[model samples]
Target: MAGSAEGFKEFATSCSGRLFRTAWLLTGDWHLAEDLVQETLGKVYRAWTKRSRPDDPVAYARTTLVRTFITHRRRRGSAERPSDALPDLPAGETDVALRVTLIDTLARLDAKDRAVLVLRYWEDRSVDETAAELGLSAGAVRSRSFRALDRLRAVLGTDGLTPTTQNEVS
Candidate 1:
């Protein structure tokens, strides 16, 4: 029992930051992200003791976070209304401006679509891995990815980075 608890702690300590980042990106709010991370870790800790092999703990944690976010969004209504306008970027700054634009654009996306973008681009997960993590089929993942990218391009303007029709995000 003690050994299992210790093992769980070790895993949590190592993966918590990455998990939190994923949660933050999913929720678009720091406080909500923290709560989601806590909930995910609690569930992971509970499962850690009973699992046989516990391979790919990161993947397990990520799947838990995604499911938790999806459930919460469903219960609270699908659309999230931002109370304030997006923050403005300083003039003549390209990187920061682009990042701010991207964040604002991402905030506008549907929860599941945003999850697909984060998993595919930020986490650099392959289609198969993303599909498995979200319990989606490969074709579904591809379609969702395409749609998300298209939405992003529309939001960011066609002048910004546009996803290729060949299924590659630019």
Candidate 2:
């Protein structure tokens, strides 16, 4: 029991930042990302003893994070309207504006589609791995990837965003 507890602590320390970054990209809110990361770590810790390998702890944690995000979105119901109020932005000009805009566009997508994008592009997971992680078939992943890319292109438009590869879309 003590050994498992120590192992979980080490895993948490090592994977928390990467997990938080992924969560941030998914949610677009730092506080929400922190909360999601904390919840995911707690769940991972609970399963630590049962987990077989230490080397892929990050993968385990990431899968947990994605599942948690999906579950949370489902519970919230995608139909709930976002509030009109916007948070104040900092006064500095930045090169990441387009990236932030892209993220905002991603937020407009369905939770599963957003997860597909993150797993495929940000995490650079192969279609097979993403399908396994999401409990989806490879064909489903490919279909969703195509639809999601089309939606992103429609929402963000083709001008400002660089053209996505056909392979990426398909």
In terms of lDDT, the best-performing candidate is: 1
Model 1 C-alpha lDDT versus the unseen true structure: 0.82
Task: Give the Å error, residue 32, model 2.
Answer: 1.0
Residue pairs in candidate 1 whose N, alpha carbon or C atoms collide under 3 angstroms: none
How does candidate 2 fare on TM-score?
A: 0.42
The candidate scoring highest on TM-score is 1
lDDT of 1 by residue, 83-167 (tens): 6677777444345576777878889998888888889886889999999999999999899999998888887777676433212
Task: Give each model a TM-score.
Answer: 0.44, 0.42
Q: Which tens-of-lDDT digit does each residue in 27-82 have in candidate 2?
A: 98788789899999988776676635445668888999999988888885744657
Residue 49, model 2: lDDT of 66
In order, the Cα lDDT scores of the candidates are 0.82, 0.80
Q: How good is model 1 by TM-score?
A: 0.44
